[model samples]
Each structure stands twice: as C-alpha cells, then as structure tokens.
Target: MNPSASKIQNPETTVPKTPQMNERDFINDQLTTEKYMTNSYNIALNEASNQALYQDLATIFKETQDCQRNLYNLMFKNGWYAVEQAEQTKVQQTYQQFTGYKSQLPYSVQ
Candidate 1:
C-alpha cells in the first residue's frame, strides 16, 4: 500500500470539518429545537406526580418558550422570516365557520 494513499484513506489522519450553518439557519434550528423541548416539558409537567418536579419543569418550560419566542422575533426583525397579514374578510369567514360549528356541539354553553 502507498503511504500517501494510506494517509488519505485513514479517517483519523483527515481533518474533521465542522458543519457550516448560516446565521438564519442556525437561529431557525435553535428555535425549532427549543419549541420541541418546550412541548416535551409540557407533556412532562402534565404527567408529573410530584409538585416540586412539576414546578421546576414549568419554570424551565416557560424559559424555553420565551427563548423560542425571542429567536422568532429576532429572525422576524432581520427579515429571515416572512409573515403575511391576513385579510379582514378571510378572518371573518374563518370566525363564522367556527362559530357555525360551535352551535353543533353536544355540550351547551350558557
């Protein structure tokens, strides 16, 4: 075996390249992961049998949620995320559709 070829084939001899993530992608990835963690924390809080554990998890969940929100706001401010404003007519139509279905519910609301 050639020495130069062996060096090329050896994984340990090769330099490990770090993943290149753009600012937008980095922030988006962090926000997505935090949102997922927040959801998991919510589930844990709901199933928590110990009050102390529940309180601790609730605090962490709120913090994670806030972090996620902050990331989203930053991205929005930087124009990384585009949000479209809904038309008033479309909003009214959605409201009417839900209200119509609400009347068909089995439980009566006073």
Candidate 2:
C-alpha cells in the first residue's frame, strides 16, 4: 500500500546491462570523451567573464588537448587508427590561404 515501495518494486523499470569492453574500446571511448571535454572547455573559455576563471579554463583546456593528442598518437602507433599525411603542396596552399587573411585585419603593423 506504500507509494515508495511500489516505485522501488516496479517491474517496468530496468537497469541497462554493461556491454563487454576491450582495450581499443576503452581508448576510443576515452579519446572521444576528452575531445568533448576540450570542446566544452573552449565554449566555456569564450564565455567566461572573469580573467582568473578564463586562465584556469585555458590551462585545463590545454592539458586536455595534450592528453587527447597523446591518446591519438598511441592509437596511431598501435595501428588502431590510420592517419594520412598531407601532401606538401596542400600544406603550402593552406598556409598561403590563411596568411592571405593577414592583410584583412584592422590593425596595421607600424
């Protein structure tokens, strides 16, 4: 007759079963989580009003970014991930494209 007891003993409520996870699965999950964390930190960093908070978030963001990069390197070394190298010409073109925007800035170098 108790409401709490009924809720606790509800037959429709079910817990999710844990799936089998391996090393690659764990690394992939960790890498994905860290990437999300860095993205969230970036948004928070942009919206932070206090300088101290901004600096703290910036440091944490950098650390998370480094950790994510390290995980990527590990996966790459283990052949778990395949990363293609950019051609030198493509790299040079991209560099030139970005550098072309320097003249669009409002500030002029004296």
Candidate 3:
C-alpha cells in the first residue's frame, strides 16, 4: 500500500506569503500559546497544595483545554491541520502489547 494512502487531510487553504503574519500564522500562534498554557495548568493542578486553589486551577485548566480544542477544530476545518489514519494492524498490535502488560499493574483494570 502507498504510505500516503492512509493520510487523512483536507485540501489546504492557501494564504498569501508576506512578511506580515496571516490568519494561519495568528491562529497557529494562539494555538501554540493555548497548548503551553494547558501544560502549565496541568502541572499546577498536579502540585496544588490547597483544595480551593486546586479547584480554581482545575476550572481554568478545563477552560484552557476547551479553548485549545476549539482552536484545533478551527484549524482542521480550515485545512491547516492534517492527521494520518492509523493502520489497523499497527493499532491492533499496539493494543495487544499494552493489554499484555495489564498483569504487571498493581491494581486490576476491570
């Protein structure tokens, strides 16, 4: 099979090449910022000492995550984001590999 056959992408929306930033550049920058914020919020959430602070961070984290998702969706809709379709065999192999390690876990998964 052709390697590119599994690529799942829409026709790219073109943007004019210019010194100034375009719509794609602006959105991409915001997306990058959102991603960084989410990561920071995640770390803060993990090490939060106070219950109230934790809750506040959690809310903010969720909002940031939602915003990130929205940005991702917008980029995808505009054909700025492209994802590759995973091969079924490779997916199944990964699944089986992980499943085989279940017995090594301290707690039961089921």
Candidate 4:
C-alpha cells in the first residue's frame, strides 16, 4: 500500500474552495491597493454608470515613512482573522480617509 497514493485519494484533507472567478471578475479584483484601486476606479468611472467616483490614494500614498508598517504583522496570523480585521479597519479608515481625502488629495474625485 502506497501512503502517498492513499493520501491523494482523500478529498477531506483538501483546502476549502475559493470563490469562483469569471473573466471580468478576474480583471476587476486584480489590484488591492487604494491607489491602483483609485486609478482603476478612474478608468472604471469613465466607463461606470455613476456620476462621481469614490476612492482614495491612502493605500498607495505612503507619504509617511512608516505608514502601515505596524499592520504588516497580520501576515503571521493563524486563520486570517487578523487579515479580515485589518481589511475591516482599512475599509473604515479608508472611508474616513476618503472623507477628508478630497481636500488633501492631489486631485478631485467627486
């Protein structure tokens, strides 16, 4: 009996399935940064239906020398709880960041 062959036949040991991605979805989620997100947002805005675009450069704009360096620790987390929390906070801060981002930002978004 081959242990490797037996292990390969077991489906229960596999990792959970990630969400499916179609052609457009793949391109849509390509970038994970607010800057690229904003640039993509810009291009998408021209093609999108809404009149104004809501995005910020906070993710890509690291004017601060050590910005987000503290949060990099999430990479060592166990089950992505840290990553999820980081994302939630990032979104909230990004929302708040973008709230005032307009005035401080380089260009107009709305």
Q: Whose lDDT is greatest here?
A: 3
Backbone clashes in model 1, listed as residue pairs: none
User: Which lDDT tens digits does candidate 2 get at residues 33-110?
Assistant: 999999999999999999999999999999999999998876666666664555667789999997878767767651
Worst 10 residues of 4 by lDDT: 5-14
lDDT string, candidate 4, 1-110, tens digits = 32322121212222345587643343224322433545554565456454333233332334321322322222223222122223455569888977886777666545
Q: Given candidate 3, what's the lDDT at residue 74?
A: 88
Q: Give the CA lDDT, 0 to 100, for residue 70 in model 1.
A: 98
What TM-score, over all chains together, does every model reach?
0.67, 0.71, 0.90, 0.19
Candidate 4: what lDDT? Answer: 0.39
How does model 2 fare in lDDT?
0.77
Model 4 clash pairs?
none
What order do candidates take by TM-score, descending? 3, 2, 1, 4
lDDT of 1 at 50: 99
* Model 4: how far residue 29 lies from native, Å: 18
Candidate number that wins on TM-score, 1 or 3: 3
Q: lDDT per residue, candidate 1, 1-110, as tens digits? A: 32323121212222234677767668889989998999999899999999999999999999999999999887776666655555667789999999998888877661
Residue 16 lDDT in model 4? 41
Whole-model lDDT values for every prediction: 0.77, 0.77, 0.92, 0.39
> What TM value does model 2 have?
0.71
Clashes of 2: 0
Between prediction 2 and prediction 3, the one with superior TM-score is: 3
Best by the TM-score measure: 3
